[model samples]
Target: MADFFPEEELLAAIDLGSNSFHLAIARLDHGEVRKVASMSEKVQLAAGLDADKVLSLEAQQRGLDCLSRFVGRLGSVTPQRMRIVATNALREATNAQEFIDKAQRILPKSIEIIAGREEARLIYLGVSHTTAAGGRRLVVDIGGGSTEFIIGQDFEPLQTESLQMGCVAYTRQFFLDGQINPMSFERAKAAARKEVTAIAAIYRETGWDTVVGSSGTIKAARQLLMQQGLTDEQGHITYAALEKLREQILKWKHTDDIYFEGLKEDRKAVLPAGLAILMGLFEILGIEKMGYSDGALREGVMYDLLGRFRHEDVRDRSVQALMARYYADPRQAERVALTARTLFEQVADALKLDEEDGDLLRRAAYLHEIGLAISHGSYHRHGAYLLEHSDVPGFSKVDQLRLSFLVGLHRRKLRVETRAQVLHAGGQSLLTLCLLLRLSVLFHHSRYDQVVPTFVLSIIDEKTWQLAVDQHGAEWPMLQADLQQEIVQFANWGIELDIVQLIKAEIEA
Candidate 1:
């Protein structure tokens, strides 16, 4: 298997949420993921972001401490079968990579920062699986740094958006010092409303058969409403119930002074901000009621990971969609992809490239020429920009950037500086993959079924490679020129690329 990890094994997902960190472990059973264990900690990572959006040293330490505890509880889950995702806080933090570097030391898996819309899609996925799969539903999840709004039916999300307004962030902005006055509440509500206003028109027009709330904020609100007798036994948060909670919340002079039957000590500080955001959402989106769902982003990640095992990987679908949307030359893309995969197989073991790397190279090959749809000149750059910015679902922010970088490096004059930049981030494996992709793309430059000669790639060491191609292919003047240029390009990147033509004497009789 190209993938080192086995599918259908016990899988885990860790959500580095803005308000809290959550860990969930599950295993596939009868085509469904059955939860084995779960835990959460209120690290409140977003609360630590400074005005410059840098996570404070203190906050970083707190998060590290929490993950350390989680590490102990991880037991024996393989890192390959696990995924850790960070939400809005890390996305906003300028120094997130530094934090991630530190966190990766203590955790079993590398943390991936997901885009907000992707977060929305995952939230909806988790909700759909946990709830009934019928009718159109609007899913709202209020996190510490952002609020995600997703409209979908069944398991497919039609529209997903994330706004930079969340409980912890708003609390810091409007309810700092824990003081809560009607004016402060109004300000928080108004600010949240402004954020929602941008998408309200379309969301309202699209409408929904039901509204679903997921996340700690929504879950807490529902619990509080139920305990306060503001909501029915079913624990649904109605407009009337929301209004009652708002009135009661405004009665408190400060978060510290607030006392309610449903409030937890840890949730008190951020509840007011969360409530205000929900109030704004209710007002602007015309939501009559909302039911809380226990499933959320982490669950969605688990399902997505499971999908990879099930051969229904959404990333593949996303790649195909991009190819179609950009009017990519499917035939040429297939040729490049085939060539790339074949080249990958030749050096994957020596280069330490895994199945994931192979998948990445194939996808990059398929989408490499998408920018041609925009313009042939600098199409690589254009394609990179589109991949970098487009809302390709199922791709993490880092995944998009890596794909962008690969596409950017595919056809350009190999800049030692640019090569160094990629090495600094991705190290040697990425460079090797890029080399393979470049060769594959180069060999298929004719864009036709020119018989590609048999080739053998041998890795001399980490920094040196030798390629032996059939003399028949070497007969092509263009191929010879391309290979000569590639040798220079590889040298620029501090790697030796030696090309040789197979001798007729060495050919099998």
Candidate 2:
């Protein structure tokens, strides 16, 4: 990783979308991104998923090959600066880890598979940043495996949703084998309408001043409409225009037989399914017209990356919101968080814990006791459940899981098997964080205001840790007992936790 990434240095975001893979590289100029290069390829990852929710080997290879090409274009940008996000395709795949492991070998950065709601939030962020912002706007992004619907104002999304009806998935379901006809289109629209109907009532009640569409399907429809003179000078998609396009689509006998002036060959197969989804959305939401925005997930990710560098990280805000909502003991939470940071600083390099890992530890430390708000009995489990399930903005699903794992293990006897499952890919690094958090919690068991002890934390090796407490014996007998139990706890995870108290050392000497 580069030690210093200048403001003018390039930043990149790769969206491993279900239908297509997209890469965007840009430089931050005066807090805004100036695009240097962008690439998109039809990977159709969603089409590769089987009935068992396993991604086919062929599909994984397509995605990996596309990423290999993208990695070639990402010149000089450090992996730390690039954000790679995977969407519904990977999220639904039971064997996504196999694909992710393969992808990581080829790409410079690890792939983050975001929850659907998080995807919606990022999509809204990108659209809001690029388009004019004022009144409440509804944003819709139709991707290969899923569609996201968001309503927000001035960069904050009030209501965000991700529906399972996506273009490529629907294309396979309703328009397989290149068949194109009125009946097929109607079947596709009816299926889409059924899906949208569930959320229509709520979204309609909370409506928008302007409706905007993002990503490939919407863009293709808007461009084709403009070329056909169905849209006005502004190139907005109207219901009447969509209906005409639907008619043109039904006239075609097969996907290849369909021809529009601006339609790309890659989009032809999935266009009808996309059109069906759009028509369903328009009817259900009562949308008369919608404008298009070039900004979507990739752009949103770039802006989010820029925000992290600018110290406006949304994850921090999310943690704060979680603490407040859970009515956490702020004083105790702060004490643990501070102590956790102290311990992390001592072992960060030794354990290969980066700043990101430190952030995860601190957040997990602050939120660890949140379960007390629910019940003191197994509060850690309660806290873990809350963090794991909540729609926390800016946190990817994996991020939440890691935090949950730490909070879940903060106080109790270590469940080695469970921790291994939760932090499988992370391995020792996450286990090390969990142990550090456990120690921090044990040290602050009293939860009263007190000066943190001056302690020397030394790593004897990867599996052993030594903590030299400054205080003499009987100065903190309660903490001494807790430390003794912690040794047994650490032993459960195959790590040695040795506590060195000043009084014991003096007596031995």
Candidate 3:
């Protein structure tokens, strides 16, 4: 079995959803992904959240156990070839790190908690790749904890939004007693309507030609509707069919008594809330009929991983978009990026850094000046705040936080707070990248077309570095002074910087 599949050809994705955990394993077949194995378990992680937003221990255990089983099935899929993303449940959990820390012990890879909009983007990518391409399309995914709405053409998402309304969440809110009555349904539909209202005007303004739904709720709803002849053979859920489904749902006084030929036992409990949310969307967004797609978050994640492997990374495009939006100085950014890369290559091995570290450093260099768009005063702080808060499409939450830390500390004094933040972001490796970026920026302080003097940087030890310039100290007094100031800053962070200049006499001798 090991010899049958090459490691590089196998890719895996795990979606730690609010209601269920899903694992999808695919094989690269002629540039397309072919599913080899897939599994899903209803953990209902969001249902375990308390009013204060802490994930309960039992829920965490359930999630961990499910992950353990999924890991056992991930045969020969290397860590680099796999991606695991957690959606709304973990995003809102106050103690999400507590669960993540425990889950990491059972799984080989770390779990990334993606932003809501990013989640929307991935869902669109999954759907676009699997479904036929048409004009602008509206894709809706209803999960256990949140629902993502995206409008996109082809493989690119034009607009994406994720709302805090989902099957499990709404079940807890409007159907906690498991009662299936018109009053409860009305309240749930009203809540969903209100949430959809926030984005309706703009969505209507930028309309889609076809509407499609993905993930568990929509799939189960479509199946049940098709089985009952409520919809056509194509499995389209029309408003009329949805209305019929609602009437039948209200027939049962409670969720436990609800039964449908195609609906799974686990899906029955949340079906009413899911139906209410869908009906509200149909009315508010004027969606007459919607089609279901098997492709979802896990599938999207696998496609995204494939893109990275092919060097078609969406992150590079996202970074470029951010730079353009903030009116960054392209030449200056290029200068810093080039110099940072040069320094990284020289010291990467000594610092135990990898290609990922180098990539992060280069990106940080390009965006280090983004804060200048808002104000010149403490612009680094402004840039940090923006990166940390912005909905960058392809970056995970940790990726944003790490980028924020590097950009924030690129210039200013390395304060005590800086040390703590560096530790939290990436530790010694991140601090080293920050230093390289700082020097790169300092070298380009003039920001002119003239080239800076050549310099050599070497690591003396873990705590010390040596920089040798090709010209005498007197040739560039400003640069010399800047270096001295940098020495003090480096000292604050427990790093020693030694400067050396090559005089003409020494070169001649």
Candidate 4:
């Protein structure tokens, strides 16, 4: 038999959740992934956020300290095979960059702060992969700072929504004093109900066959219920059991007094708040029972990474979806993407570009004209706004911003602020990709099926590039004029673009 599991074929994912940090390492055997190791720590990162949405230094340190230990447990998992994802806490923190910069120093991979919808999608991916399929299923994950809800079939998510209500955040909001009174619990439930109301109608309209819960909050609930003999044989939490658990919790005057068999001390503080939110969901959504899953965001990240390695990247699907949604011309997109990729190959070595960079350029090239769907006037600006703001699945916040920078500056005069933004996002490498994309778009300005003249692009130095075109071609004059204009644009961006005729010997060779 062919070797299904190669030596050291391991993948890792780190989930920097608002309340805890999780590290999961898995090995790919055959077509399935089996967990090799896992670890989690309740850092309560969201609990550190002040009223101003600023993450406190103490919380930042707590997160960093946890990551420092996680890094030690990484073992043989290389940086390229690992992904770090941050959820609601980092997304809401005003000074998140300050925390991320410090965390990056401890871990080799940079942290990706995913949008809420994207987080929901990943959560569903993890659940669907781990659990047995049953028509359509509703997956809910109550985290530290946010709760993600997803309805999916098998491995595909149908509807996804994220609410900015979580155990840690709600604890701060309604249970800071540890009081478990009916009024306080009702208040918490009312607040949760209000948040759920926004998407309740649509979710109920598109109902599910089974209800599954993931993440630490729900997992803790199931474990505690099982310990108390409140769960069914299948380990599902029923509405009756949930109510009974609530009654039990309300008997305690404070969080410290709340006690249950098999309940970890660390989970005590957030248990009441988590129960309130879950109960609120059950009442509002009319859910009868919920089955728990060990899978969650970190597992989803590993599965996503595996897809990338297996040539089934979801980001490509997301890009195609965006293009189709914006009514982009596939032919034009193909033309520009092909040309951009060709240019990328020529200077990739000098620019230190890799397959990932090439992928970004290709996607950006295909989407450069998405803004034309809105209006031709400053459509680049419009397109940039759409890309940055759109809840695109399988893309991180930084990925969207970098893509926006390329599309926004593809045709217009490059602004200093735009350049600064691009530099801050991906630095010189991204700028080079932008330059290549611009040249490709310029070459196909006529939007015709006619072939573009052969051109050889070479790097002269860090800030200089030389492009030798076939001067004898029929479209030479028009192309030359376009190049001259592009030269001025490149100069504005502090890059020199030198154009010359293609040498006969070089062309023939």
Candidate 5:
């Protein structure tokens, strides 16, 4: 993990957890991140989950209230630089979009609800950066609603897993009765172990140089252990210390009553489940001792964000890697991109499309055919399918869906189903972009060794878009037919499509 970005920009990461919301602000100093400020609010978002996995009104308000305060602290981050990641709570919620829409309106940045495995990767990255970089390490981060485990050598993560075990969620399941007993403790520990069982064999095989832990739960546990004379000054969490802590926790008969030294009141109820999960991880993976790191997901996100500004963007690399892995046609894709961009410029003034659209259109054109790897039969459709299904690193699900839908609908006969998917994934703007992409693909469909048709396209009114095509040596009946087909297809997108031929004498008016 060489530092990928220049050290000029200030970076920040906000992790919206189920039990807590955190902000970590730091500046890149030499080759390391030096923290400027940090804050956490125990929002208990996971416990606020109702029977249907919907965040309760109280929980929603709590999150909103926290963001309102955080918005002030955000100060100067552009939407692109600041990353707001929601973990398991929004992943499980049916109405996450509702909350997301509200949050986006309040804040400058878009919120990314990452998958569990991605969360694990970032946790490892952050922990590795803050801890010693030598040797392979097993890192565990138990949060409010999910637990992440990773085995990484130096900075590169080898195995990543996220389990449905967390302090807040487990506390709600077992300790909500407020009458924790030996049976409840056993049940919580057993449940956590069951989740960890899925990855035990692989991680055991991969092994680790040491075991490390992070996050509030682990931090609290380390303090309690040291204060109780269970661990050393370096915060190496050992199996013996874990068992001793378990015994002490069981003696209380309730998480509330287990008041060991250095325990905070807010962490009192949730600490036992976190400890149980950590203990289960240690026993399952056969760990001797583990260190701790203050760095976790947020720190990793800040570094990643800075990478984008400094032109070391992981998203761009991920895209290029995916294209290579799928054996996509670079030359042909470039041709299409160039043609699409030419058309984009012609329409930019008329359509009022900004630089953002130009960038998006170019990317969509580059990846318009990745699904060919799956099958040549309707390869465009296949490419769309792969994009929507595969977890291309650095991409959110929504971004993949939109890109895939654009590629999927770029060709073939348009239908209502296509329109619905475009609308669902991207709404009205997506539908318009899909129209633009289809036109570009159609213009370059022949993929002739010659240059694609240069064209001017403009939105004439709220419902009408017109394309004026420049002659390419000779009139192309194939392209003309494609254009006629597009008129019908554009109707599906609720746009009136017009095609007009251009000659040198006629200024394409």
Candidate 6:
């Protein structure tokens, strides 16, 4: 966590957006970001995805080639200093992991694929923080594979929803022939309206005082509308401008012939589709106008990265929220966490782990039995599922996945024997984490008499861990059975667990 971008050190955000990939490098001055450099290429990776949601060879090459160029500008920045976020395209891709594996070979950084709602939240953060603080604002960002709509005030999102309608996907579905007729635009708008309709009721009920549109599509739209002299220099988009734009789009028979001033070359083909989605949003939600916003997800990612260092970690808050939501036993969780930390600290010298390891162990101990709230049987597995699948605001996609995997494999079965096949970089860490979690859980197997007995731990890599217990009450038989059952499970991780019942040198003779 300390490796977070030092205020003096340069920071960067690489957004693997649906339509294009962008790299932004900036310097922090008193917490405000001053953009030093920025680069974006129209990769159209979303369009490159096949029906099976697999990125084609040509598409992968295009993305990698663009990243290679960006890599040159990164200078001496480590992967830890830069945050890379992949959007809906990878989220939908069946072979995303393979693509990521190949990408990491060239980029030397792991990519995070954020969930849709989280994406919406980040977009809102960027918009809110960049813009002046005023009344509640509705922000809409139309991406290549997903469109995010968020209503926020004061840098906090009030309501967020991400839809599967976007420029690239809409272009493919509605304008594949490259002809932009009135009926074609109407149909595209209709499809977009259908997607938006699901959230219309809630959005209307929780209406924003002002509407702001962000992203390449809306920005381009606002620029074009300004060209028509329909809007002022503020770059406001209006419903009447959309009406006139529709008339002009209908006049142009084909997309190749359609040219609007200030429109980027790559945005040409998808412009119509993007406009249609925008039109749909306006009509369905009755948005009279929308102001253009300069910020979006990439900027938000940088702020989030910086926040982790400033001690306002959203991850910790998200974890605590989960425990509270699930009605987890606070007393049990705290006791287990303290006991686990004591043992971890005692063995940290022998184990060669760090404070980060301590934090993870503490969190895992605190929330180990949250799944028990769902059901008594297989609660550990259920808890794992919840952690893995839930949309946690402060955590990166991979971070949540790793935590979930640890929780899942805590007591039931060790999924660490096959390290070669492990998908995450923290496989060893997870195994160590699971060992501590299991010990904590087993220590408090009974609900009453909550004080955890003293214990000592010795680590022997992934395959073997030994525990020395100092006390055995009348419940010794039950605890022995529990610890022995864990030994068999630990073997699955290729580790032998040796439980030493070392009593203080005293016996009732």
lDDT of the candidates, in the order given: 0.87, 0.88, 0.90, 0.91, 0.80, 0.82
RMSD of model 3 against the true structure: 3.1
Instruction: For candidate 5, write residues 1-509 as lDDT tens digits.
Output: 23355466567889999889998877779968888888889998898888899877788888999988888877864555578888999888888888888888887777888878778877887888888786888888999999999899987788988889899998988887566677777788888878888988988888777778899888888888888888877768788998888888778866668686667788988977788778777777777888889889988777666655566766667678878989988877888888787777776776667765676677888898888888889998888888777766566667777788788888888887767867776676677677778887887776766855656677788799878776554546788888888898788767888887766665534
Residue-level lDDT of model 3, residues 156-272, one tens digit each, is: 899999999999999999998788789999999999999999999999999999999998888988888888888877778999988898999999999989988766888989999
Model 6 residue pairs with clashes: 463-494, 463-495, 464-495
- Cα deviation of 332 in candidate 6 (Å)? 1.6
- Please provide TM-scores, in order, for all candidate models, with all chains considered together: 0.96, 0.96, 0.96, 0.98, 0.91, 0.92
In model 4, what is the error at residue 326, expressed in angstroms? 0.8
lDDT, candidate 2, at 6:
74
- Could you give the candidate ranking by lDDT, starting with the highest? 4, 3, 2, 1, 6, 5
**Per-residue lDDT of 108 in model 6:** 62
Best TM-score among the predictions, by candidate number? 4
lDDT per residue for candidate 1 within 309-402, as digits (tens), equals 6678899999999999999999999988998988898889987888889989999999998899899999999999999998889999888988
lDDT of 1 at 385: 98
Where does model 5 exceed 4 Å of error? 1-9, 349-357, 416-424, 505-509
**Which residue pairs clash in candidate 4?**
none
Instruction: Show model 4 residue runs off by greater than 4 Å.
Output: 1-8
Backbone clash pairs for candidate 2 read none
Model 2 regions more than 4 Å off: 1-5, 473-475, 503-509
Q: What does candidate 6's lDDT look like per residue over 1-509, in tens digits?
A: 56445567888889998899999888888778767899999998898899888888888888999999999988866666688899999999888888888898878677999999899988888888789887988999999999999998898888988999999999999998788888889999999999999999999999889999888999888888888898866777888888888888888888888888767778889989999999999999999878987898988888887777676767677778889999998888887888788878867877677776787788777778789889989988899888888887866677677777667767765555434333354756666776777777777778666555556677765466778776556556777888888888777667789888665652211
Output the worst ten-in-a-row residue range by lDDT, candidate 6. Answer: 416-425
Given candidate 1, what's the lDDT at residue 29? 76
TM-score of 4: 0.98
- Structural RMSD, model 5: 3.1
